[model samples]
Target: MPAPPIDARSQNARVLGVELCGDDGALLRIMPLEPVGLLRAGRFFMLRRVDGTGPYIPRPFSVYRQYDDGSIEFLIKVMGPGTRSLAQSSTGTELVCVGPLGNGFPELEAGTPKVMVAGGIGSAPFYLLIQQALAGRHGASLAPEDLTLIYGGRKAGFLYDLEAFMDLGVRVLAATDDGSAGFHGNVLDCLHKQWEVGNLPQTVHLLTCGPEPMMEAVAHEAAAKNLECWVSLETYMGCGVGICNGCSLATRPDGPLGAWPVAKACVDGPVFSTSAIEF
Candidate 1:
């Protein structure tokens, strides 16, 4: 039998996959869906905001899967009215999406030491990267212990799937603002103490996602230690596809004083190097 002729809009699909982030949080899948299996793994995605009561704004979510399922996925945390409406959406609803957007991390280099810092729900994007890294094939020869995930949550329950990361052969270090598990303090505090004790590992690069302040702290720490770092920014979006300026951000490290044209977080990047961002 012939396949469906293929929807042109499907090539830039939004309804890629839907899954639960937590109990109340819902994560939507996205993809530049095309002839099945064409989408590459690790590419990014941005999609239109579900039309809610008012205050129109497109939300940005990283495409966690682009593995040719003709769909990709995004992880979301239900924060307010907009996301609540989105969380209630039934699967198979027609959606407007964009990309495979923004540049992602350079695959973990062979034998290169690396750290993944996830704040709250920011761990979404690197879930796949962790899987790949654990396999020792991050586009270069690598190893599982060569990477680690240091994630911070408000408490023990907020730390999702601790065993999943551990089973992948990646040591998952954890911290809670409340000291419920692992360490008691900021994830950065844990990182600094590790660095002080010479446990951070050498030749390490950091890949991170989470709240802006958290990512900023991680970036600053990485920069101070002369470690290479890549940060995924989570800014509010009016249009996840870059059409709206709501998601725009100042590009240069120094804004107004030394900053310049702001780049749209949805387009220019949801991921960027520490040097490229003001935060």
Candidate 2:
């Protein structure tokens, strides 16, 4: 079994700030007591208020951003008590933070066009990924034209941090269910449209993170198209480490993780190739 990174340890982090974003989300920033070195885009942290104001079990959040000052940000949708507590946090508030956990997205391949499909809050991890790809931080830097983001939501407001992503100078398209945003459909539909119009190549690498059903649909599409695809599962985790058996998912018998009947989302991955796991 794989283990959490050696640098993974629980520590108290001080709240630096919280900014309301999107329709019902907050960009919560905190400074860990100890330095957490460079973090990969999709890696996450387990967080909870130190004052015991929220659930005893800390909630997991993807690392939205990591600044030079050693502070990290989590783009949290104010959906439940766990997130609400974090949103209500004030400067100087202390919270327990665990990790820099799990494997992030794989390195970018040169000459392969990449398309990212994000749903609502699932857009969290892509920010850094796009930034890194453009900056050549990931192996084989990509041009802005080589990267595309198809961000979707029920409405415009769910497409969190839209302008920020656009500022990166990559192709960013919006999709909304109610026709209130860019395209009058979901992300998958938007993606198909791009291909149909020749805005994107038929053969391209795909990466997605969002609601389970959305991810399932994208996975099915990838399988049918025989395209290489990866998914960042938004699984419910009791513990962001391997100690708890709560985040297990069924594995594909012929896939890379087939040796194991099941894989733990926490340590094994929050990111896995679509071929390695069943939807």
Candidate 3:
């Protein structure tokens, strides 16, 4: 069997800062007292609220960005009770964090042209990813022009962190269904247009994270072109570790015994190849 992404650990992390961003999203920064060497781009942590109680399972959040001082950040949208509590948390609050769990994105070949497609908060992991790419940390020695981002949301305001990518010298194409952004449609439409006009690189690889329907649509497009694609799945979890089996995902066969297999998202992956799993 493949090696687990990273060993799990529980640490008390202090809230460093919280800033409201696009829409109802909050960017939270936390600093762990203990060093978590496993924390990095595309990985995640399960945060147990300090005042958490019954029915409140620990919440899993992707590592939005990791700082040199070992601080980690999360870009969360307040959609429910758990997130609301998190958003209300103030500086100095202690959260029990368990992770750098799950597999990260696979390394791409150096100099390979790449395109990242994200929907709303799905853009979380890519911030650190872009940072790594800029520093040549992921075997990807890409220049600013070699990387492009196609991001989509319901409206322009939903496309948070556009400037973050822009500052990294990445080309960003924004799409909003309401026509309140760069493209007056979904990201798939923008990608299709880029394909039609040969605006995309000839040997491009795709990295995407988003709502299931959107990711599935992007996967289909990649399949049609026989291009390589990687997808990060978003799912609910009872425990941030694999023991709960709360985040199982159906995957394509790795062996001839069967066509489908079940894998734990928390430990096996929050990231997987676009063709390897069923959404």
Best by TM-score: 2
lDDT of 3 by residue, 31-54 (tens): 987877745578888876776631
lDDT of 2 at 35: 93
Stretches off by above 4 angstroms in model 3 are 1-6, 53-55, 254-260
Q: How close is candidate 1 to the true structure, as a TM-score?
A: 0.79
Query: C-alpha displacement of 154 in model 1, angstroms?
Result: 1.3
Clashes of each: 11, 0, 0
TM-score of each: 0.79, 0.98, 0.93
Candidate-wise lDDT, in order: 0.65, 0.93, 0.81
lDDT, candidate 2, 105-145, per-residue tens = 98998887999999999999999999889988867889999
Poorest 10 consecutive residues by lDDT, candidate 3: 254-263
Which ranges of candidate 1 are over 4 A from the true structure?
1-19, 27-43, 48-57, 66-68, 135-138, 253-260
Q: Is candidate 1 or 2 superior in TM-score?
A: 2
Better of 2 and 3 by TM-score: 2
The C-alpha local distance difference test score for the whole of candidate 3 amounts to 0.81
Position 63, candidate 3: lDDT: 90
lDDT of 1 at 96: 48
Instruction: Tell me the TM-score of model 3.
Output: 0.93
Question: Predictions ranked by lDDT, top down?
Answer: 2, 3, 1
